[model samples]
Target: MEATFVIVGGGIAGVSCAETLAFFEPDKSIILLSESSLIKTVINLHAITRTLTQFNIQEMESSEFSLKHPNITVIHDTLVEINDGEHYILTSTNKTIKYEYLCLCTGAQPKLIPQAELFEEIIGIRDTDSVEIFLQKINRAKKVAIVGNGGIASELAYKIKNTQVHWIIKDKHISATFVEPGAAEFFLSSLNKDVQEEQVTKRMRYQEEYSHRSGAALGPDWYKNLIIKGAGDLNIPSEIKIHYETEISNIQRSNNSPYALEVTLSNGDKFTCDMIISATGVTARKSFVSKNELELSNTGEIKVNEFMQTNLQNVYAAGDVCCANWKLAKHWFQMKLWTQARQMGSYAAKAMVGHLNNEEVLQDFCFEMFAHSTKLFGYKVILLGLFNGQKLGTNYEILIRMTKGLEYIKFVLEDNKLQGAVLIGDTDLEEMAENLILNQIDLSPYGDDILNPDIDIEDYFD
Candidate 1:
């Protein structure tokens, strides 16, 4: 009898798993189920937009992969309950599916803040519509305030122009993930100066009065010209703003106009503002899955092993929804990254196919690499590895070479084995550096050539 395989979640994780399973088990039957339509507009409209930048955005190409396939059945419905035991599996949609193997590539959902009431005053931008609405508000208002300190916040802060940008840095610095201290400092300096001074605004960190002060010769009246809030921990030279452990309280009508509103901080501090934006970051959404079937973390992430299998036997999980093993360090990362989800789904599919053939499938061994590349205000930022303490293990030797406009850091072994690294502004050496890490090359003979800025070192990996 031919085996039937059921894959849940229609996003990158689900689709990629199906693709992989199709390649591994050509004769097996496959079925896919999802709540949202598998369309670009639906993704850009509802899901996080960063998915476009992180993975092969070309997959968004309409003609690429369809939910409908010869050996696949795509169901556009949410999963309410799941029953997987000896032979048969049932879904809440009343669709009974019997599979030799099951893959739970279900992704996560956005996190809603505890006190979402305060967001009413802010110009939120989680999607295209939100961004458009916020832009309209910015064209009219002079000042803008942003919430949270993460990559999203940093991206918004770097994009502010013309209006005053107020950055509320509850934390000490910007994204703790991608940037090293030196590069982060430089990136923060690249923001618009006039905006930070007159058009830019921010909350005071600790007892310091200049936590968000502008270095320009502008006076306090600059605050009257316009106000803006940027999301993230912004570094302005030698200043730091620490909110400690305060949260937003509430937002109310300005009493004069519908467009104006008052923002209340958790500490009872009240401020009247024209607009606010919640760069507060997103959370994982997993409401589609029945809580009783599989285990979920308090943070909304799904639990899975290295093979992407959940607590339930025969059911596997992957992507931003599942916990990831951070490679090179004793840390774990969970988020909505397309590449990670796709890879995990692929792995799960292979393992499932192995079950049918009674063959042991190879589980993933390497730690997860939480790297991303993007341009902020014309400056290019590329993260190659996780910052877990393991990246700096005593066994690994870190070599850094810095020039005026570029920076390169390579992780080498005492025995010359390439481990990992972070490369910024060095476009020419990126491919070579990546090859070294991927191939785990032995650079013993190369010696100083590993850091050489000019020659092509692609052959070293082979």
Candidate 2:
């Protein structure tokens, strides 16, 4: 088959790119080669701010997606090889497709612990399939050990109940991936108990499922649709024992013991469990193409320039499968997030279309600052810019204001200019926070009043 544009992978990034291409260039043929029968699409998206987007992921049938666009065709197949030099690709089913422009949204694979492959009881949560298998295992498990401090680990640690949970981490506090020690400490109380989830106008995200695809996308609120109860008939939703400042040093399967697995920690602590979840993080999928052909980052992701184009001509990549090689905006950075995947996909489409028309395309405004809205421990969380003071290290200063269970607010400042912020709860400071970071407005005169409850920050900023 031949097309003007071809996108690989069925995840949000690829699907978004395909939809955008089909929308703008209706006269041209667009092919979306997907490995799975399902495609993930973003719906009910609310642009809380320019960069901060809240949306739900809908896993649509690939056939349904194809039906929506007359020029776009969805092909259920996996890309086995890429011939960038000749501008063609080989699929697993032995079909050769040629394209004028190609975008690789192959996504990522879980970076499981080294011993993950040695045992069947240990698993890493990635797509819907892994989560389903994990649910089945936990439904019968008496005890489970969770490792990692990222979003997936934090969610699993917070949501799963009715079983003994040993949350092993190498951080000083919980939820360190999303917040600082202070914010994490605020979240500690909620971790050990069932806190009431607040209803918010913002939309919550859900995972993307393909009938049986390996590289589907994961989003939040997955537990709502599925049962998270553990072994035992009494549905007591408590008991998450957090092992802070440590990691899983070793894991072994038991042959005759009552427990299915025994795990050892880095601090010489050992625990026996029925299941183990490795949520360390994800690495790029690079098996289809060689590094020599397409440049790769140190983290094993495809390196793409400002145009989202790989080193090869007319070949581009987005989402978890690619890395931004260009110098990033001061406040904006890359994270393998649902919002970022959508932004990158949409941006990639614009860049490709501009390339075809020989038009100059400027960088997207969404790249001006890092913004995201998510739920952690059932609380609404909004992150802007370098929320954790990221690369600024200890050189920066932070102003914090909180009321325990009610809310927690933090501001990262450098030379009295707002650099980043973390607003946990219904603070309604997203617009002000994003504008302050993007405009680089000096806050020296305002001082700590920037986070003061009495001060009308929205009015001053507006």
Candidate 3:
């Protein structure tokens, strides 16, 4: 008659799920298992989003969460294996525990992108340790090269001022992940703060006004000799070099030079460098669970119903593990973000308790369209709902409002509802904007407020 719930992982999803479960069923026992002792510190790429006041406030510091939850037991051990049957789970530490329910919030791993081996070899920046090593290498580096096409690459291109940057992007254009073409242009323009727009008019195709700030511009020949290759390989020298979308085929020590290490690329390409860091994205980490433990999506994420219940009965999953159909991006599911995982954890816990009560629950406890926003280096990037453009139909009304280098706001209005937006630089109306997106509020009042920044229109949504 023990109603004990076993939660795996100590990240935001796992912690939040434990909190929710503790709240719903105070009489039931709750235990949280984590690989790291840093129970509160979840590996978040968008840590700035947590700092921003526009979103939900994080209650406990990463280190203090377990101390706050007296009812939640925490075990700091690596989850090397999981054998989740109907009533129990075997831990990596050789401990067996009985549970009425199991929650899988064990996040993801860094994806070893095939062609990104060179990038990983020279300037990888994949994690905290890698970023530290990269910074150390940069301090001593005369020139730096970047690979990949995302916010991290964009920020790296803008941040490292003294070092010469050779950015190799597979795509001809800028980040196609969050921003649209027009907004992408604006963001690209912001990178070239050292150069004026008219001075680089020939490359104007890459220069779109980012905000009213006046100086951001995507520099000239900054990414020259930009090789467009598919699934390339990366080879590294003893010094520093990064190859994009490439894999390391072979590695060996130099015969003549004692300090030199030689590497071969998958595509027969070779390069030598001081250090390598991989900014390659994260992988959905389910390696511990036996392949037959649960059904997995193509992306390696756990397949779950609307209630966050995994294919394995009583095994609930939230966060990066659960499939997410983002409302703003209009894409089905993607990994490598903390926002969806946090919401999914809360929803999963709620649904689990609801089932215990034999009560009806919402189809999905969380919203379909998840929003994420963060500041990479200095540039502000916001992703609302979904972006894949599949759910809202082919045709939708789009209004783009901008002020060069200072502000950029693109509103996706469909059926008179503010579907989604990506805001940058100026965030005066950020909270109101998010409220509108979440509630799908009528857009008439905020229309004038957007143009006239001086208006104190508190009743816009009211």
Candidate 4:
């Protein structure tokens, strides 16, 4: 087997790269290989700003890749070995495929804590199958212990009902991955509130049998319509007890206790729960490729330059598998999110096409600023640039405006210039805020009036 381009992985990054290449260079042949039959495809793309984008991911059949692009072929196979010297790859089924250019998008896997004996008791949610397993376990669980404070942990903290939730975090506040201390405080109020009935929105749902092979990470609204209730059928409001500045020190099954297992925390607190969820985080999946073949970061991520090319000629990597080895823009930073995966994949395709054609390629504008939109506790959340004043030390000023349960808006300013912002709820300030940060417009003349409720910020910026 042979092709002009061979892409490994069927996640958002690999799909986006293949589609972009097929569209730009229709005469060239492209092949995509995946371990699973389901592939992630982004749809309903809306560019909210130059750098901000909103999109939904659809889990499509792997065959759809070739159906959509005649120049591309999709194969359901796992890459077992890569011979970089000869530009050939060996599949698990003993098939060898040669390619002139190869883009690796194998993505990352959940970084669970080292617990070899308790693997069955600890579950890490990453894909639809993992979520299904979690739901099955929760159905019989009266209480569960959740570890980590990222997006997944935060979402589960709000979504899971009827179960006594013991949320363990190593931070001073909750949802520390996305927001600052003040925003975390604002969200803390909603933990014990009643779960309000939300209006259902029309969206496509894809169902398939769970496979042992790891699939792509679940997308936005992954828990939208899922039944997240636990076994305990209490009429009272949901209970969530947050243990800040704590982590699991030890976990083991208890023979005498009523609960299934006993967990000891680093803070010397112990609790018994029916289940334990480890959302600790993810690490790069680079074992397939030999360490002697390419250079990798200390964290085990493949190192890629500005053009997304690795040290090896004609080899590139994108998505969570690769770390940005170039000097990033002031506002742009790397987060292993779906949005960055799509952007990097598309940009990598352009770079590859340009290199093949002996043409010069420029850096993508999306890398100029960091922007992300997501839902947190039923509220629309938008993060832009250095929203939490990251890397700015203590030389930054913060202005905030909150309207009870309606909205919470915050701006991070350095030298009277907008450096970042956080908009929670329907604040309708993302576009203007993004422009202010990108253009580096000084807001000093407005003083504190920038966040004044009476002022029409959008109109003023216009």
Model 4 clash number: 0
Residues 55-154 of candidate 4: C-alpha lDDT, one tens digit per residue: 6666667677577788888889988888888889988899999999999998998988676246586889887679888889999888898999998999
TM-score on alpha carbons, each prediction: 0.69, 0.96, 0.71, 0.96
Q: Model 3: per-residue lDDT, tens digit, 1-462?
A: 123788887666887688888878877788787765544432222323222213222323334765666667777655555455546777667777778888888776555446444344454443334444555566555444455566567656655544344455554455655666787677765564542222211110111111111111122122222221111122321121234445556655546642234556655765443333344455566756543467877777887777888877688888766674333233234445555566678888888888888889774423544556555324556666543343678676677678877777776777666766677664555555566666777766566444454655435554
Q: Which one wins by lDDT: 1 or 3?
A: 3
Ranking by lDDT: 4, 2, 3, 1
lDDT tens readout by residue for model 2, 1-462: 999999998888998899889878989999999878888887777776777777777777777887888898899988988888788998889999999999999888899989898999889988878977887799998888888998888888887778889998899888888888899989888887774554754755765443455776676666655657688546666688899898888888766778999888889988788988999988887668532378888888999999999999899999999999999888889998877888899899999999998999998898888888788887889989999987787888899999988899999999899899999988888888888988889888898888888889889877
RMSD of each: 11.0, 1.7, 10.7, 2.1
- Each model's lDDT comes to 0.53, 0.85, 0.56, 0.85
Candidate No. with top lDDT: 4
Residue 97 local lDDT, model 3: 71
- Candidate 4's C-alpha runs over 4 A off are 116-119, 198-213
Backbone clash numbers for all candidates listed = 30, 0, 64, 0
RMSD of 2: 1.7
- Show the lowest summed lDDT stretch of 10 residues, model 2: 203-212
List ranges where model 2 is wrong by over 4 Å. 195-198, 207-210, 233-237, 255-257, 290-292
